[model samples]
Target: RVIEITLTSPMPDFLRLLAQPEMGIFLDGSGAGPMVRSDESDGQPLLLTPLPPEARGFPAREQWQSRARQVAVSAMPANSAVDAFAAGEVDLVLNGRLSNLPLADTGPLTRGTIRLDAALGVFGLVVRSDDGFLAEPLNRQALSLAVDRSNLLQPFNVGGWQSTSWIVPRELANGAAAQGERWPNLSFEQRRDIARQRVAAWERAEGEELVLRIGLPDGPGSDTLFTQLAGNFTQVGITAVRAGLREGAELELHDRLARFYSPRWFLNQFHCRLELGLCSEEADDLVEQSIVESDAQLKAQFLATAHNQLIDSEIFIPLGAPVRWSLVRGNITGFEENRWGLHPLFPLSQPPT
Candidate 1:
């Protein structure tokens, strides 16, 4: 009924994390490893929900299996899933953002069916391109300062959404966070004025007009955020334009959930080799040191130093917490709220108590 794991290094929070929901040891009786698939349904009409693509390899326990016999699984885009859930076609829809937010005036979405998870991870724009005005670190920092992060999620109309300028969420940093906010004392407008000055300096020195090509998704949230960013850039004496994710945009949002709640995990996401674009080698060195350092305080120091180094380099323009949401029918059971943003399919299929 239990399993034991021995770590070569100290992982103080390992036991705490293991005790959380959807966390456990499993016996891969199939021996497929990462190639594993969903639970087998014995020819039942009800559909079983799906785990995230990365989680397909996890074995399905009997308790997590659907109460309905031999159910199926459906995968589709968020919008289509919303439409399907609104009708009686699908039993459950997961990971739909508020951009396709069906009108609250009607439908199951208006009821208590909407579920939002406060996922902890990097949800912000990274400097994807090294060319253009972004070539300079100060210019990148200017862009970070110019954007009104507080308003980026206005399109969703959701509350309690945490907007932050730091890569690691402060509360989750343990003792690793050094300073709280990047600009705690400065007002949003004050931050913009400083950014405008920096941008003006770049324009005057280079004699080249500033342009920021931001890569974004094709959705209402992206539109609102881009428009606000463009306006902010304009006020800061730079022009902002939207670019496709692959269209050589200098900046793009990287919304992701942390596999493990560690500052190192958050810091590794932006490493140069990770393909996250323009990162500090010095910061990478610190992260590497933290990996081998046996001293706990020394490790925390390294992480804190790396975090502040990234902030100073303006490698990523922090937005807010990554959004993970789903519309579950009122009758649905076994869907529990968790920070990891993972909802097992079998649990959603369990009949309502």
Candidate 2:
């Protein structure tokens, strides 16, 4: 008999590819499955579907129950799904966010958890080139130096999470240096100072107010973090507008916005772009070379150059990295951790005995 599984995300192109005949897995969500009339049923072979994008607004627990036969809600916020898993109403609970393991083991009901990726996502600042004040590399660098990354992470309880070196996380690279080791000597304060001096130099070249528009996501902690960053900007006499989710897309679309935007910004978990409307002829050439370069060393050099240019230009301000965690049941086999914090669930050849 085929082992059926359910997934909990809006069906993307990749997931659809995984559900093909050659893939040999049956995947669906509660929305596509037959309506269940009862709370409990004898264990049966069925493919439950994952969560839909529209369902993200629903409570996490409700979302979980809508997908798996058993809900193993891990470090995600406590919700009805977690309560159901704790009460032994579900078969398996998978934690989506950073795991919040209980101090006391709940026996067989509780499963083991692991950190899948050291850095899951990133947050940073972007400037608008059209603003005219950030036309020079020194101007951009000054903005970068003004940010206190350590202080930014303090409220989030992630003080140790340092700034990233590459456009993507180190783990994602095939043979590149880890982001942590690239610049060990530069302290947070030093980086800020560098940015200040750069900005001052730019002012000498062309006198203009270094006004900036900062776009942030509309979720929890976004507003608070940006507010803190604004204080840091003020210290350097840079005028900053704390734009929230409302202004993000418009900022991205504005062609002149690249002056302030980092090409290597993380839009979401799956989407990361190196250029956000800022066009540098040299940077674009290097990006193209990096993508096609077959030699490992050459590719690394190209990527490094691009990274440095962006930094030197102060195109974007490096913020703290985001953390993501996944939890698995003890009986579940073949669930290896990945750099992306994702696990392969398709090759489910066996069920927990």
Candidate 3:
């Protein structure tokens, strides 16, 4: 049986899944496969193509038109997709960024629900290790002290409780305290004074300006944050150069700092690499040990030790934790919320009548 699934937008992950053997679904033009449709010459399945507005007069559309069942896949700005779902124009919707929108107690869209999961992403700051000024622990600590994390979360309405720690929240084994409680209390002005004193002493010893390059994505929000951070650093006698880069540009080791998110496994590997300088014998051994340790407690301890070492070295300055949410129809079944906030579709099915 062909199960017609509609997505609000296309993502590479979903497209790849459709081509998997277990799914038993085939593209329309491709003949004789695991899945079939009524119109095909053999027992093959139909692959429907959505012609998004961006595809207008494009060669790709001609290819899609000849091969698959055509449908409109126009860009629905944010909440507009919810309206389309309400009108029964589509069967399934894929949304990545859903803010805090309240759901109705009961409605026609009763059989579907939303799942929140950690988007394979991370956001943090990276300092150039070669910068002699940044090499000092006090300098790194002072830089961390200057960030206003609360203001950062205002746009997304998520991630304001505390700054991020070296360990990922869901993976941390021990019952740790709230991240906000770990840091010392110091006002922004006071923090600047502390950093200034430390930097002054360092400049006297080294006889050089403590200049830093702050690489930021060229955007309004990033610009605002960069300005604020630059101002804060300037107050502490740190000269900051705001270098704007195109999205997805390759940053060299000497480039200012950058922050991004990745899958948990990748992030763990990254932590090991940054601490152990990547692919070194020490990093490889530690990673192997953590994975193979049979005892849960021992494994936890090992990971914690790794985390502590990374934090103490200041490989990356963690900014804050992510708060995520999802919206679903009233009748959606089998959707469970996990610590990481990821919702897999395999476990979910339409509610029984």
Best by TM-score: 1
Q: What Cα-based lDDT does every candidate model obtain? A: 0.73, 0.48, 0.48
Question: Compared with the true structure, what per-residue lDDT tens digits does model 2 show for residues 18-86?
Answer: 533345433462222222223434553344334433453444453444334422223334344455555
* Per-residue lDDT over 59-99 for candidate 1, one digit per residue giving the tens place of the 0 to 100 score: 65564444343335666777667777788677667765533
- TM of each candidate vs. truth: 0.81, 0.53, 0.53
**lDDT tens string, model 3, 14-123?**
65445444555345665433122235344332333334323433444333323333322335544555566677664444443322222211245443344444433345
Could you list the CA RMSD of all candidates, in the order they appear?
5.8, 11.5, 12.3
* Native-referenced Cα lDDT, model 2: 0.48
| Angstrom error at residue 227, model 2 | 2.6
- Lowest lDDT block of 10, candidate 1: 30-39
Give the candidates in order of lDDT, highest first.
1, 3, 2
Candidate 3 lDDT: 0.48
Pairs in clash, predicted candidate 1: 41-70, 42-70, 44-70
